[model samples]
Target: MSDYQVFIGGSAGSIAPVITILSSLPADFNLTITIVIHSGTDSKVSISEILANHSALTVIEIIDKEQFNPNTVYVAPSGYHLYVENKHHFSLSVDRKEYYSRPAINVTFSSAAEAFGEYCIAILLSGANEDGAEGLLKVKRHGGITIAQSPKSSQVDIMPQSAIDNRAANKILSPKEIISLLLEYNDLA
Candidate 1:
């Protein structure tokens, strides 16, 4: 029952700190990081590729009907929403979008709250929209730990600000400090 899921929010112009912090984390740890990065439908920065050159952890844009594993990273594909079913596997929904966003950040974090409950850790990083605010709140509602990038230090700040404004995130820090928090919590996990 040792499981952890983190939802990170940030734009391509904003997530280098996130990638750096997460990539430096131990690859064999019991936790799993699920990143919800923003990209235009045709944009080319592969989430896996960015992390591949940095993390020793296995990383992939999770596919439907795929089995879940720890010590790996799962990313939601560009056009589909990502969800979890009982923490055993992944699910994708392309029917509609939430928060005016396809592949919505809220959808992912809320679903994880259902699947992982208090074991989840939700993080909100830099971005231009308010996509992940309520979702991070949902995580907190279910007893999960919520961390937000300090809006003052974020490249975009809006995304993280929204979460903090909504009172969703419990702790706020810069990306480097977030890395320290993650390592501390990983030890706690």
Candidate 2:
């Protein structure tokens, strides 16, 4: 099996696409999937539970130093930044927020790029800010695949548009198209 790790980042208008993507993946999906979505720091809701409702795969909020495993979905906790310490583990931080948001896309994406290198696949979805653009670029520079949701197909275009504008995306696709690509990759493993 491939050692690819998928890192998905999003903010406003991202939940629907995230649900759609996770729901489409089978329980035995071959890659480890990690997510970082901007959420209110004080909110008590669990994004992992919401994703669990849509996915057959195990979905849990990330704990510091937790090991990565295939066939599971890990959600970055609110009010913390998530990082891929290596292929086998994750680290969480309470540092200052980036782009005025904790669980910043850039933090996760850049760290995943560093940890996984060419085995990483980074996806940038609908959001209202430019937080993920530079990090996606870093992923691309590190030889990882970088995908951005097409602006026209997004609930809010700013985030994906920013990544496209910065030439960070290797592919610009609709949400369903992104799912298709993931399925194809899954099949290859």
lDDT of each candidate versus the true structure? 0.79, 0.92
Could you report the Cα RMSD, in angstroms, for every candidate shown? Answer: 1.7, 0.9
Question: For every model shown, what is its TM-score relative to the native structure?
Answer: 0.92, 0.97
Q: Which portions of model 1 show Cα errors greater than 4 Å? A: none
Candidate 1, residues 1-189: lDDT per residue as tens digits? 246666675653455876777667886665778888777777688766777677877888888966677777777788888887667888888868766666888888888888888988988888888888998999999999998888777878888888999899889988888888777767866
**Model 2 alpha-carbon miss at residue 153, Å:** 1.1
Residue 40 miss distance in model 1 (angstroms): 0.9
Q: Who wins the lDDT comparison?
A: 2
Q: How many residue pairs clash in each candidate?
A: 0, 0
Cα lDDT of model 2 by residue, 54-129, tens digit = 9999998999999988898999998899988887899999999899988899998998999988989999999999
Give the Å shift of residue 94 in candidate 1.
Answer: 0.7
lDDT of candidate 1 at residue 184, scale 0 to 100: 74
Task: Report lDDT (Cα) of residue 76, candidate 2.
Answer: 96
What TM-score number comes out for model 2?
A: 0.97
Error at 55, model 2, angstroms = 0.2
